[model samples]
Target: MPLAVYILGLGIFTQGTSEFMLSGLLPNIAHDLGVSIPDAGLLISAFAIGMVFGAPLLAVATLSWPRRTALVTLQAVFIAAHVAGALAPGYGLLFATRVISALAYAGFWGVAVATAVALVPANAKGKAVAIVASGLTLATIVGVPAGTVLSQFAGWRAAFWAVAALTLLSLICSVLAISAGHGATEEPRTIRAELRAMARPQLWLSYALTAFTFGAVIVTFSYMASLLTDVTNLSEGWVPGLLALFGVGGLLGMSIGGKAAETYPIRTLVLGTGVLVAASVLLAVLAENTAVTIVLVFVLGFAGYITNPILQARVFGIAPGAPTLVGATNTSAFNVGNTLAPALGGIAISAGFGYASIAWVGAALGTVALFGALWAGHLQYRTLRTSSVVAKGTAQEEDRATTHA
Candidate 1:
């Protein structure tokens, strides 16, 4: 892929690190700000809500801007927000900063995905997306752990400061790397045109599939620490290592799925979602077996992430005329799942289903996603068959006209 693609990935890495590192630092933040842990956890929901709204809104607002300019501007905003977060003296200020940072991050993500797809051939779109998304996987592997370690040694504020510094670097690199004219769409689309594209039923289906598939994984993952400690009876210290293992599985899944999606998008989705459902079921059934639970966690990551590129690529395919908006909406769809899964998992726990119940929730979501994928495949087949019939009739008409001539 283009160097700009990798640079965008690097940018994503910084933002993703900031987004996820809060999970590890919540306890420290709660204590420092004189809040309850649950209150501090709301910071995560604040970010997710920001992402859900910010993506589509910013995509339209910046629809006419140059890709590089938009990306750099968003990164600058992100850096400033992180700095504010690092320096904030109270919980309210920190929460506001998190919302602002997430807005910037979400906008950056939408633009980056569109830019990455614009930089590649149609056949290579999945791989390009995978390359960009690899940054998030890498963030889970390297950045989140580093932030946790930094928070442990230097305080939580230090982690925010580090993220701000890294974002500044990414902003500078983006300025130098992305060409001024390399916007995702050749011509800027009007908001009206993008809105019209959303009329397609298939596009909506794609978004639903994206949400369910991702939600399935996140339901279990959101409560993984509790499951490990309470159900599997592991030490809290093992949490980071296990999370890293999941990240490793995610990276591998992305690599495999990216290559396969270009040729077999439906099959890739089906297999990935199917495996995810199976893994969740297995995890739920075997939670008490420490080794089995550990192995299933890796499988969960792998199965969950393998469908990501396909989910991303299919939206672009379905809505070729509205790349930016489609990208933004897809980003929103992801956060929708991120936002909902935790609530559902919490409800299940509150209902006395326990930590393992989250896995059952995941399995249920994955099964829905799996059926959605199969339905999409059927629709694709019908569309192709109709197109083929039309083409054949046109060819026959042309042949008859030629004979008359």
Candidate 2:
């Protein structure tokens, strides 16, 4: 992989930490801003909403810009937003800053993914994506926890300041490392051309698969703490450690899937989603058994993440002509899942289905994703067969004309 790819990953690490660290700091934020915990939690939703809208829009707006320029500009915006957030005296301002930060983060992610794949060979695209995505998994293991600890010792504002400083470093590294001409589109694509590429059915299928696959795990993961405490009978202290364990599993999954997805995209998706469905079912059935639940949690993380690189890489394959827009829409699709699954899980809990039901919800989503993968494979097969037939017909016609000559 290119050095620029790793540098982009570093940028993603800082932004991802900011994205998730708010969860740990919500209580502190709520108390400081004189708001309810639920209200503070809306900050997270605000970020998601920003990501959902910002990615596609910013991607198109910057479609013709140099990749390095777009990335650096977005990082600068992100750093400024975080600084504003850290200094904001009231909740409304902080919320506005979160939205701004997320918009920057989402735009950065779309451009970064496009740039990473552009820097690598077609065969290595999945691995490149995995390398970039590893930053987020690492953030789950290291950054979020460290931010929580910092918030505990100093204050929540300190965490925001730290993220801003780190992001500033990333922005500097990005400026120094990435080449100006690398990953610039050979020809600037019109917005109409990009939108035209998105009209493919296979591309939409890929988007749906991406959503369901990620949503399957998030549905359970969003409420993992409650399940671990109220159902598994573990103390709160164990939650962080177990969450770290899940992150470890995700990292491992990324490593394995990255190497396999370029060669076996459909197979990787099938196997990964299948395991995810099984793990969700097992977690639901055996939630009362602490050991079983713990084991399945790791399995759930591993299974869910193993398909991530494939999902990211496959869209580029399906819509090679419109990588920027495809990348942005894929990012939006991911947030769609992120936003919906938890809400659905909350409804289930409100309906008295219990926390375990979220696992069942995950299982259902995974099943849909699993079937979608198979369907995608079928579509690829048919397309290949049709192309083969057309090629053979053209060869026969050429042979006939040569014989007559």
Candidate 3:
């Protein structure tokens, strides 16, 4: 809503591109360095792993700092990592740099979400967070594709250099923006307290939903290039473009999800997730036709992204005490899905399953996730119903006693 948010979105865009650009550059990187493609692929995994670990860890560690300071510091770390990645001599150094960058990316987003929420009024918190998260999807539409092309045309090193420049700019904005009042201190939360908050069944279920959805998407997305070339009979040149198409859908879905979250989150999750399931089915069925595949892939991206904000907001509702921890852990859940999905997806493909089979697998996973979301809605309803009944009974008992007196 604010211009500051647009600046904040820049940081997110930079991080998102830094995180995913490698998918497009893997071949160039491996060939230049004389490494295997699968080995180079691990760099992407490393960044994700950093996000998974860095999210919760930094969220806890930075509890004492001003939100702005935390974000700036992490962005600095990301910038330094990118510089290192650009200058990295061998695969080992590059992989290590990704881990370092991940720490920053994870920490930056963790603080970014908290800062975004605090900046807004109570009524607008849902919308504010969605807008911030949308930066990640927006990166797909622009950042990653641009970086991919830059990596090829200018060399992979140039791509990292570009991301570094963006991160440095984010650091500048992080310093200039953010009001003192908004940066007011937060209550410290220890790991034990964080764990206690997560012990709630509803809280865990939300995380489970995050994990499942991420897994479903990542499994298909990791090998989406292969699918494009092998199943759809497209050129390697189309990989980044198709990926960007998915991001376009994600951007649209997230925008729609933000509005939907405002009116009725529960219904949104159930129905939005159902869309993802159906789109996955369409993608699987249409993978054979180039024209049809192009349309289905974008639809899948749109459907999958629309569900992100709802799942995120649900976690906050269930575990309000550890807000940062909850959000960070949910971020972790997304990466966990990323990690498991590709490995499993690859296994499915290797076992003689067609490339399209991965989409079917994702579709099946989406079906399960859709049902899980519905179950979460039911659980939420029952909890509220019980609380209302208890409150009403207490009021009646007090009324009767007052009359007797």
Provide the RMSD of all predictions against the true structure, rounded to 1 decimal. 1.2, 1.3, 1.8
Model 1 spans with C-alpha error above 4 angstroms = 184-186
lDDT tens digits, residue span 150-232, model 3: 98689999999999998898778767776565553556656677667777888888888888876777678777988999989
lDDT of 3 at 86: 91
Candidate 1, 1-405: lDDT as tens digits: 789999999999999998889899999999999999999999999999999999998898888988888899999999999989999999999999999998999999999999999988999999999988889999999999999999999999999999999989998888888866555236756889988877899999999999999999988988999999999999999999999999999999999989987999999999999999999999999999999988998999999999998898889999988989999999999999999988999999999989999999999999999999999999999999999999999999999999999
Ranking by TM-score: 1, 2, 3
| Per-model TM-score on C-alpha atoms | 0.98, 0.97, 0.95
Q: Is candidate 1 or candidate 3 better by lDDT?
A: 1
Clashes of 1: 0
lDDT for 170 in candidate 3 is: 75
Query: How many clashes show up in model 3?
Result: 0
Candidate 1 overall Cα lDDT vs. reference?
0.92
- Angstrom error of the Cα, residue 95, model 3: value is 1.2
- Each model's lDDT comes to 0.92, 0.92, 0.82
Better of 1 and 3 by TM-score: 1
